[model samples]
Target chain A: MRRWLAAHWRAFSATLARFAGAPLTSLLNVTVIGTALALPLGFYLVLSNLQGLARDYSPQPQVSIFLNIDAQEADVREITQRLKSQPGIAGFRFVPRDQALKSLQSRTGLGDVIAGLGQNPLPDAFVVDAGRKATALESLRAEFARWPKVAEVHVDSDWARRLDSLLALGRYAVLMLASALALALVAITFNTIRLQILTQRDEIEVAKLIGATDGYIQRPFLYLGSLIGCTGGAVAWLMVWGALWVFNGQLRPLAELYGIPLTLAHLNGSDSMATLLFAGGLGWFGAWLSVRRHLHHYNPS
Target chain B: MTQIVLSGVHKRYPGGHEALANISLAINAGELVFVTGHSGAGKSTLLKLIAAIERPSTGSVIVNGQNIGTLRARGIPFLRRHLGLVFQDHKLLFDRSVIDNVLLPLDINGFDRREGTRRARAALDKVGLLHKEKAQPITLSGGEQQRLCIARAIVHRPAILLADEPTGNLDADYATEIGVLFRDFNQVGVTVVLATHDMQLAARLNPRLIEVRAGRLAA
Candidate 1:
């Protein structure tokens, strides 16, 4: 076990020195990979924020039943009782004709115009809260619309449903974009690793001639690929966070216009770790494939 | 006490080119032997066969009690670990400093870093290139570069040393120096096999000479 650790340490340090040997080339490779990775990750962050804001700000669907203007007060009482008994109905509040007109006058500042009319124009109503998703409440609104003595039924917040569908489509597009960028990252790593193997061909041949095993010859290149990948992942993380910082400056005023306290989330700890690990794994795999293809062509003889 | 024993060894490459044919020879431990031949006369092939870099087509090559012809692919590195093999060209990594080139064999063996550095320096000193340890191989003279290759080859202190034209590209003075270095190592009980086409240099060294003509050993 001790020997294994020592061997790995040696290989690691040696590979690190080789990378440090050519800093500009390594930096160029890493920058390209980082930029490729950042596009998908940035889109994901935007989609997540959109989903979050939609959840917090979009009002719930409310089913409102309006009684006939000539219906007796008893009909309003009966409808309220019926809504209370409904299984899915969470709660209901009754608004009489006079009370509705009074509140509308106060809210809209049309009290004098209402007094000049000399009669209440609003009908008695019950606002029912279904306390369920839009789909379930939609059916409740439909049923109430068909009830006797109901002059009209309005389902508030229908715009929430439209926004939900639009957001779902956006999420799907982001997922597709993420997949395409991931494939691009793999191909980039593959090409870089292939070039590295070619440049080190003479070193590998000499090592093999002097009794170095295939594993020994391969270790440094594998480490080179992984270092590039992990550093690229770190660069992507920096890019996303920096973008959010700059974008949040513009987002605050827009969020204020809608009266929602919005703050976009950065990647959580586990998410960041996963990103780094995933990038490093791709790099290791690319290096493994490149080395396997070329090592067969080299023999000590 | 025989270090290498080849019996009826033959090597036939694909496309029907036979490089060695029904050759049998033996060299005892601590013996300095020379394989002298014309180009394509199988001198290099015989050394490669003993190094286990190429397997014989039809016979046994026993080196230090292991049958080279029957060794598995995974066992080749281990066989080479006990033998020091040198090439004629492309022997040094010009990108690395001389000491680093010598440290390669020790590095592959996973030797302790401090101890490996010490051994690498000692090997460089043995080749009388200690003052040039930090120089890149391209900056060294041809003889210095070949000596660096020898340093890298024997850094791990292998029991057998095989050189394929170690002095082929050097002047006579440098060639004599490298030949003397081989003689010095052989005096200390290391089996040395030097292959070359330079008959004059071979006569000067006056080692146990074996001649090859065509694909067979000549008497």
Candidate 2:
């Protein structure tokens, strides 16, 4: 165990030494890789932070169940009791036509025009709320439309469906971007490692002559590639975080106007760790491929 | 105690060049032997076969009790660990310091770094280049570079040391100095096989001399 630790430690330090040896080339590779990674990551941050704001800002779709204009007080009491007893329905409230008209008169400039009609022609209604998710509210709206004496059912979840479609599209776009950029990361690291192997061909020849195993020959390159990837991941994460920090300041007044507590979601610890590990894994894979292909040409005989 | 034995070994390249043919020989442990032949006479190929760098097309090459013909890819490094191989061009890593070049084998074998440094310095001292330990190999003269190669090869203390024309490019004085170094190593119980076409240099050392002509041992 000690020997294994020692060998890997040596490889790691040697990797750092090699990276330090050519500072400009290493910096160029890392910066390019970091920029590629940050693009998709920025898209993901926007999508997640938008979802966070939507959770608080958008009210769930409510089905306004209008009864016949002659619905009695006894019928209203029975319907309210039935709605409260239903399992899927969260809650409902009774809204008399007169109360609805009065609220609309105060909210709009058409109060005198509305008062010109001496008789209240509007019907009594119940606003029913199910769970906030689109699918549930949609199904509840459908169920409520079939209720006895329900003269009309007004479903306002069309905007919610549109918003959901947009979110889905954004999600797929982010996924596609991430996939393409991940490949770019792998290719960039592969090319860099290949160049490194070419430069170190003489050293590899000497090491092989001295009985270095294939594993030993490959160790430092693997570490170097992974270190580059991990550092790039950190750089990308910081780029996204910095962009959010700056944007969040601009978004504050808008969020305040909407009366919704809103802030952009930065990557948490596990997310950051996963990103680093994923990038490092891709870098290691690239190194492995290049090393396997190129090392065959070097024969110590 | 035979350190190397060859029985009916044959090597034919992909382009139909026969590099070796039906060669058979043996060297005992702790012996200083020389394989002397002109260019393309198969001396280097013979040493490479012993080092398991190339496989024989026929028969066997047994080095230190392991058959080169049957050794797998993973077994090559383990086989090489017991042998020190020196190239005609020295093959020194110019990017590293003299001491780091010597430390290559020890590092590959996972020796503790401090211990590896000590052993590397000792090997450098043996080659009379201890003062140049911190210098880059490219800065050294040809003879010093060759000596550095020798130090690296023997840093791991292998049982057999194989040199393919160790003095090929050296002047008479430097060649003689390297020959004496081999003799010194042989006296200390490391089997040495120094392959060279320089018959005069081989003659000066007066080790057991074998000649190769057109891929077979000449009688």
Candidate 3:
């Protein structure tokens, strides 16, 4: 094992020199891979933060139920007590018709028309606030629908449903984009490794000729490919952070629109580790596939 | 007893072209042998079979007490370690220096770096190019590069040496020098097989000749 490691080190050092031997080509290949990886990473950052904002600023649901004008004061008190007792129901507001008419008259420039003919024409109404998710308001809507004195059930935050759908669609789009870019990244690395293999074909075949095991011959290239991939993944992570930094100013107002206090999330420790391992695994697999294909076709005999 | 034996070894490509036909021969240890024929004959094929680079389509080949015809993929590398081989083009890694080239076989055979380098340098000394150890193979003349390849082949001290027209790429002067170098190695008890159609070098070496014609041994 010691001897194998010694030989492997020499092999690795030799391959490193050879890889860095062509400086311009190596740089170009790595940059191409890094850029391919960055697109999805950047999009995912934006999409993830948007989803977070959607969750953080989600409004509390409120339902307004207009009561029958003929309903007595005792009925209103009974409804209030019932609304408070239900699970996930914070409370309700009861507005008498006289108070409602008075506000309307003052705001609509009809305040002094013989004091609105000495009678309030508006119906009494109540406001219901949901204590939890917007879905929790559905029971209130149903209760209002079943009420004999209620005219309508109006949920103020129902439009948030459309926003939820949009956020979900955005997530799917980002995932699709990320997957496509990852494929492009794999191809870029594979093609670069393929070209490198082509140039080293003679040496590789000669190695086989001289009794180098397939694994022994494959070790250095696997390291080379993984180094390139993990380096690209590191660059992708940097691009993700850089893009978020540049867009931090714009994101604040967007957060304000939803009354959310959302912050940008760069690749975390888990993501960085995942990226490094993914890049290394991707590179190793690509090179292994390439070498296997070549060895099958390569006839040193 | 014969150290290298082939009994009715036949190799046919999947496309149905026969590379060798019923080849049966015996070579004693320490004997210098020449596999000679026109182009397209089975000389190279025979060498490949013995090295386990390719298996026989039919029959068996036994070399150094092992049946090479049945050797699997993993066994191929092991088979190559017991023999040193050279090619018509010299097949040297041009990116490496002369000493790096010589140290390659020993490196594969699992020698320590110091010992591998020491043996590689000594092998270069044998080929009379100890001073050129640091020079890139491309920097050397065709003759010097071929000598470097020979040094690399013998560096691990394998008991058998296989050459497929080792001097074919060199000029007459270099070719003659290479021929003399092989003669000296043969004198030192390395079983040598020189596969060549260069009738003149064959006559000079005066080795036991095994001729092939159209994939069959021609007496």
Q: Provide per-model DockQ scores.
A: 0.60, 0.76, 0.63
* Cα lDDT of model 3 by residue, A1-301, tens digit: 9987887788778767876898888677677777777887777777677676666666677888887778888878767776677667777787788888878887988887738478776788887777767667787689777866667788887767778788779778878986777777677767777887788788877888887788777777777778778877887787777878878777798979977565688877887798778876777777777777665555587
Which CAPRI tier for candidate 3? Answer: medium
Alpha-carbon shift of residue A156 in model 2 (angstroms): 4.1
**Model 1 chain A poorest ten-residue lDDT run:** A52-61
Considering the two chains of model 2, state its CAPRI-style docking category.
Answer: medium
Stretches of candidate 2 exceeding 4 Å from the true structure: A252-263
Candidates' chain A TM-scores:
0.87, 0.91, 0.77
Q: Residue B124, candidate 1: how far off, in angstroms?
A: 1.6
| Model with the higher TM-score, candidate 1 or 2 | 2
Order the numbered candidates by TM-score, best leading: 2, 1, 3
For each predicted model, how many residue pairs clash, with residues at least 3 apart or on different chains? 0, 0, 0
After superposition, which runs of candidate 3 have C-alpha atoms over 4 Å from their true positions? A1-15, A59-73, A80-85, A88-140, A143-160, A249-263, B12-19, B36-41, B106-115, B169-190, B197-219
| TM-score of candidate 1 against the unseen true structure | 0.88
lDDT of each: 0.85, 0.88, 0.81
lDDT of 3 by residue, B122-169 (tens): 999999999999998999887887888889888888788999888777
Ranking by DockQ: 2, 3, 1
Full-model lDDT, candidate 3: 0.81
Q: Pick by DockQ: which candidate is best?
A: 2
Q: Candidate 2 on B1-219: residue-level lDDT in tens?
A: 998999999999889999999999999999999998889999999998988888999989999899999988888888899999888898887777889888889988889989999999999999999999999888999999899989988989999999999999999999999999999999999999989998888778899998999998899
Candidate with the larger lDDT of 1 and 2 = 2
